[model samples]
Target chain A: MNKVMLLVDDDDSLSKFIKICVEESGALMEVKQVTSVDKAMDYLQNKGEFADKSRNPDPYVMLLDLGLPKTSGIDFLKRLKNKKEYAGMPVVILTAMESTENIRNAYCNYANSCLIKPFGFEKTKELMKSVTTYWGRYNRLPDRAD
Target chain B: MDKDNPLVLLVEDNDGHAQLVALGMRDSGIDHELIRVSDGTQALEFLHKKGKYESSQQPRPGLILLDLRLPKMDGLEVLKEVKSDELLKDIPVVVLTTSEAEKDIAKAYEFHANSYLVKPMHFDELSSMLQETGFYWLACNKRAY
Candidate 1:
């Protein structure tokens, strides 16, 4: 089955470049970009209009950005880890926040992985390629229920 | 064994992650033969030779690259299983995932996961990490046959 990769970054340029590179890599990722944490939840849980799996298939992996409007990445992680039902859901913190403190806190909250977002487009593309290569194709993620 | 092949089992769900890891391993030039399996269930199957893996496949994977959050079974569960089984317990299982959750980290050690790696997203960084990881596991550490 084909896989879905979800990203919640407000940066349009970064997201576009990442999407293009990811597609070009031939990994078969259906990239979903949401601007906010609420939308992220909506997409992941298939809430509201996203209920249609055809449009919003539950992602095999989630690359979450730390900074967001209203709710922060840490807050989202707090909520996500708190829920026992979604334990199988592995969250990768893919954000620009690259601090040891942030890394410590994010890990404290039970995030599956924390990735410091790359700065340059080329660097970002390389990061995206490697991350997907390891987790998506090489490593086996948790299986889907459906 | 590919004459000089070192067995490594990788349990990760994402395809992109797998590709980059492959590249990194190649860059490191370790000549480690990698085995890919998705989720915890298949991991168990591979270790035990159940289901599609039915035994008699030469030497077992020398090391395991385990992702913490897996479907059907989580990494912790699989770790516990690997550690518990006397036949497979001796082999090393490395917990390599993106999460740095305190509880998860603590729990991984508690379960006796051999090593833990929080994956770097950038390719260069990841390559370096793979170089280190591959070297440490394949070269530095001694394993039982």
Candidate 2:
């Protein structure tokens, strides 16, 4: 079965591109896109409109964009890592930031991996392939129930 | 393994297994120096730069390849220590071990291991895994430093 991927990015076009890439890479079954950290948290917590657990099964992996409109990805990461139940979820920072400080900050906050957004379509696709192969296929993720 | 290459600290007690890992990494497209430690204690010592490794020339490793069933301290213990420590926690630790036990898998993730892989029986499979690992973790994945 294809795994679910939760994508939190403010850019609609980029998120759509990532969804296509992840599906084409044959790693994930579906992509749930949320524009802000609040929405992402609502989805994860199964709150409000995201109340149906069956429809919103926990994501196997999360691709977070750092430069969100509100509640930046770094702060969201810190919050997620602090929550006992959500702490085990693997978070991969998918951002355009190539700065050393941002990279170090993400890692220090316990991001499982960080991927700088590739400039070209093919490069982005290739990155998605690597992400899927390693995280989706090889890496042993925590049990979904956990 | 070239000295100038990024260092990969490998913790495995079995000599034959360690050699196989070295061989696998040798063919992995990314080049890196492989530092071998037999037991969990040695692994910690090497990472902490304590014990005999106090004057270690190698800087902190960019990545760690750890085995579960080890002597002295065990892989899970080593993983917990590394993940909890402020300085060493950022370095990715991939649990490379033989056991496919569900318990081991769960425990490794609980401690925040970057990834986990059950060693394949075939040499070719091992080599393939090493390639993928090196390609992703070394080539694609961003480092904190």
Candidate 3:
């Protein structure tokens, strides 16, 4: 089965654009967009709307937004780092914020990597290609037997 | 070291800044394909080939241009994951954000990020920085993969 990618962001429109950018690469990418921190956690935790495999499978990777409402992205990172079970899951922060404080704080919490949001679909297209190529192999996840 | 296929991965959330980075790379004629992600979570999803990114469109990146500040996970989380993973650890991850904080830089190095770059806010300065970044990372540097 193909791996899943969860995109959690409050910006509804940007979410759509991100999906298109990944798809435009034609890499068999399945982009899932959630609007809030709670919803994103649900997707990762396999609760709520994310429980269904067809509708929302376990993401091989997650693109998280930092400034999420309800549960802040930083808080979410802390939770993941705190839990050994989910620590192996590679989580990259992608957001509009570019603050030194956030960067330092994220590393202190043991985040995998921090990224600012990209500009356009064209550039995004390129980013998708690179991300897919490398990230796909970084984690040696268990191959779910069909 | 100047291979175009190994592409650059730019993980930035700001649309305007992202454009400048792309343009800067373009101006330098690095001729490398760039993949940009908005947040750290997205960056990880893309790197791990999970979530919406099961299949891959291009080859692995030669360099990663990462932004320190991100929405969900932030850059440090992303960096730790990349460095910890045996398969992806060797791949260069360059932190590119606007933080001049010493702690941020020190922590990034501690996580084993390949490099750190503070993004210039000014358009002209940013452009020059991008060009230099492209030249250094894409051209001058010796790439392992």
DockQ: which is higher, 1 or 3? Answer: 1
lDDT head-to-head 2 vs 3, winner: 2
Best by TM-score: 2
- How accurate locally is residue A23 in candidate 3, as Cα lDDT from 0 to 100? 74
Report lDDT (CA) for all predictions. 0.72, 0.84, 0.70
Ranking by lDDT: 2, 1, 3
Candidates' TM-scores? Answer: 0.55, 0.90, 0.51
lDDT of 2 by residue, B28-117 (tens): 678788899999999999988899999988989988999999998999999999999988888989999998887888788778887788
Runs in model 2 with CA error above 4 Å?
Answer: B1-4
Best-matching candidate per lDDT: 2
Candidate 2 scores a chain A TM-score of 0.92
lDDT of 3 by residue, A1-146 (tens): 56677777888888888778777877666788888877877877678766875667667667788888888988988787666456445577776665656655665555555566768877666666544533453223333321
What TM-score does prediction 3 earn?
0.51
Enumerate the chain B TM-scores of all models: 0.93, 0.95, 0.93
lDDT of the structure predicted as candidate 2: 0.84
lDDT of 1 by residue, A6-89 (tens): 888877788888888787767767688988889988887789868887767777668778888889988988797677555555
